[model samples]
Target: MSLYLEAATILESPQTTSLKAIIYNPSKPFKSPQPKLYALIVETLKFQDILKEVVENSGILKLERKLTPLLSILLTHDLLLTKSGIATSSGPLKDALLRHKARLNAEFTRARLRRGHADIKSLIGAVNAEHSRESEDGVTKTATGLTSFNPRWVRVNALQTTLEDSLSSPTFHAFQEVGSVSDMFFFDVVRKTYYRKAEILPNILAIHPSHDITSSELYKSGKIILQSASSCLPAIMLDPPKGSMVVDGCAAPGNKTTHLAALVGSSGKIFAVERDRRRADILEMMITKAGAEGIVTTLKATDFTTIMEGHPAWQASYILLDPSCSGSGILQRVDWDISKLNLPSSDTTSSHPSKKKRKRDETLPNGSASQPEERETKQLEEEIQDDDTSRERLQSLSDFQVAIILHAFLFPNARRITYSTCSVHAEENEHVVARVLNSEIAKERGWRVQSRDENPLSTWHRRGLVGELSDLKSSLEEQRRVADGCIRVHRTDSLGGGFFVTCFTRQVDDKGQFGGGIGNLDIVPAQEDKSRSQVLGDTTEVENQEWNGLSDEGPNEAVSAVDIADGDPRSGKRQKRKPGKAQQGRTEKTNRQFQKGRKGWS
Candidate 1:
């Protein structure tokens, strides 16, 4: 009956009938202490034999900082009280548990427990706070209740099939039958439709179409993979500076690796490295399934950072770094029932019912977007919260991104490097981009940007991750403009995941320091009010005069000024329009640096 007695029982049989009973009990609120914390404590106690053996034999007297991660669990679960608990060779399991001690101290936990209880009824009530999926039949355009959305796509490898040929396949027809999806416009002439982000479709799931594109059939193989369209951009950068060899860091799941392999074709070699053995196995299987043999070589190389030290071919022409990122970009799943709370009674054995559907509460839509008053009210009250937790996650994820970008350069002669993440966070996108460009080594290595027109279907842009990307004065900005061409892509505007990608090239001919002296954040000072003789305070349009007599380094080979009238293509004067996706994305991240911070989709 006592808590300690029950704890002992749990330790005796980690997989006892009683433990399962508590875990699956819907009516029995999980109110006594934190379950996650308690569960970990019981697990450690259950494995005491092995732990004791190691600890005793190792001659370790007291546990301290090194054992903190393991010790914290016990302290939190109430399994071991400091002064009253068993004494080991050292003292009680207390000191080194500093970080979690304050958190798990019984007094603190019980104080916090005044209002939080997790019984079957609470669980059901939370999920069914919205409409019951069992009751709702029509499709909802908003993904408000969804937790995960898995969008479908196709990968077209030239060696296997051209985009045009693949679409005509009988298999392609079968796939269409499985789902009702419109053809993606951003697709290449041969294959792929950047469908997910563009959200060209109303929802993530595909309704069975009247006709279909079957991917599995005779004369057909898995070479054409079902991949996320957002994952395809890294290889697309292969459109230029075709490399002789490439490296895919963290290439497990093989989709991106295979894309690179396909881009390089048979003549080029690709090294796909995965450190985890189990994941490496999966990668190998995917590689085989996709028929990417001879093109990609899978490696279980742990020290990829130093892989180049041994083999001479370690120096690659192109390196693609798709490090692991949070799956935050995924559309939510369908089990979410955001309306209609369904509380369960105390004795209802959780049986097979909760698995089928947990009931829940949901938020109602604010109003019509077309109505200004309604939209304004909704904007103020229904605005999504970008809390500190989400921001921290963005920052942590960006750190990994920055690390990978910096590491990509370790390979010698990697002329082109493309960095991308499915994250819309500026911390992950522009911040990382900014930090890498500012690095002394990146600058010294002669790496420059390859900016291009991004697709118009991403939210990050509307939020301002693009336009304010880099002031034209920064070397990275100039270099990127030279490479990728500075086109912004928006998920709302295009059919792909909210993704950020840009290419870079090493100075090929060692040009004379990129046009002598370009200032930081350069905006050719708008023309001095030539006509009115008024002092121009930023709004004057300078003839994109610098564009006319561009050096060989410029976009074109020709150097002729066009005769101009207002808004004419021949006119040197640049017409102003709202900032494209790129500009919008930039403004979203940091606006005090720019003017339009208030126009955001708040």
Candidate 2:
């Protein structure tokens, strides 16, 4: 706790503030931006972690699930407000925190420092000295891992050509085959690059960021795309049939749309829906660039739920629902002023700035605090739009997500549907699945979890959590089966951040019938069936509530009243409960009551 406070204080200092500006804002240039910029970003990321720790320990800021990316952004501003700084002066972060009344209790911060916690004075002194040096000479000791840590991944357009063919071509002479792992052979385009990930996909290549291939013939020809492996999982898991129709419910910046197009082939059709007109334009461009315009139809500025009965998309066999989430899975993003950097140059160059020079000092880091000076009040309102990480906001997002999936469930021919999110929250993942399964529509239409044995990515290893499936109206065995059906990838797995994917399928005899499976807690063993019935029958004298698992008893006393029923002479010899109409009806009635009692579990 003290460490977090100290780090926050250091990050909020005016010296750190000036250093951040000089490093991030090119207009406020300083000599030799490499070392100082790297140090500044590293320190900012450290402070981001510190802030996360503070939020987790504060115990007051009850985040719905995990901290939303927008909340993280706001928290950094609050960290600045810990002491007097520009971020504290009525800016958007401060304003947002104040508006929501979400600021941390001061007792958890500066008060800890005043107490006898382990001293952070030396750490503060060191950071201050480094900042002072950077301000003076615009240089500081560089941190490691910046170069090796950040890598660019490229996915080959399977519809165009194979990875091996692309690598063998004269245009890709600079690339070499990566080592054999995951039975996936990757190509390293940048020689001497440090390898971490073995494979993103069979066609995707993870390479060093130094390579400049954006202008290459292959990229221009739309034979390769820059997409992370994690983002590619939904399309892969959906495994749409060759001639089937599919819907990308929240399609925008259509990376997955093009990938789905390739999978479905030219004979198949796709309905790409996007609510935002501007993003829809970009999606259209990407679809065109990928040469999928023939098969991919764009539903520009349209909400997916509005596609009602008799609509062309209604007949689709597969639907991919990648709704708007908190985007907590994104590890990092690099943003820069492209117009300023790529402007025409003087002297003897071919128009635009030299590729090397343009790329220089363009390493703007994300996944941490933003450039404080750049993201003032107006920008915060524009960037975040609202408090996306708040409990109310999460509930809203979850409700919207549930509505999208439920609407998709109404599709008559929708045989397979994949619901995916970049969020790690149960409210959006397992809970959503449970809520949908418990819905009258899902039960009536025979929608249930597509078992792992039936899914393509069943061998991916990491599965959904069982603990989060407690609210689902299914037996423990069925719950475990459903958990195994879902897939989860952590942010640190190097597969392009955290992600969750689960496929829902409909069958003639889908076990999703309401009041059939109320979880395992209500089940009775065959050996105890007769005794249990006798106990229930004899309990006319004793209240039903008296038959709990156990109650306080002395050493010489019996553990439970249940033992008396087992030893009763009236207990039937037949151990099995007869599967007759009378017994089944009674069992169903009991289950209904049990389910009603457990309604508050979620």
Measured by lDDT, the strongest candidate is: 2
Q: Top model by TM-score, which number?
A: 2
Model 1, 1-602: lDDT tens per residue? 12333343344443523332333242444333434424344334432322322232222223343443233334333322233432222333444443344433433333222214232223222232232221111121221222212233445656576655655665554333322233421122213232323232111222211112232441234445544455566666544233467777667666677667666777777777665554555565555545566666665523234343234335676777666554333222223211221212223322122223211121222222225444322221221221122665555566556656765654556667777665444565666766777775467566666534432222233332444456333665454444233222332222233455666556654553332122122322213312111121111122111111111101111110011112322223432222234323432332232213321111
Q: Candidate 2 local accuracy as lDDT?
A: 0.53
**Residue-pair clashes per candidate:** 95, 0
Q: Write the per-residue lDDT of candidate 2 for residues 536-567, one digit (tens) a residue.
A: 23221222121111111111111111111123
Clashes of 1: 95
Output the lDDT of residue 412, model 1: 57
TM-score of each: 0.47, 0.53
The parts of candidate 1 lying over 4 Å away from their true place are 1-151, 173-215, 218-220, 240-243, 301-303, 336-389, 453-496, 510-602
User: Candidate 1's error at 317, in angstroms?
Assistant: 1.1
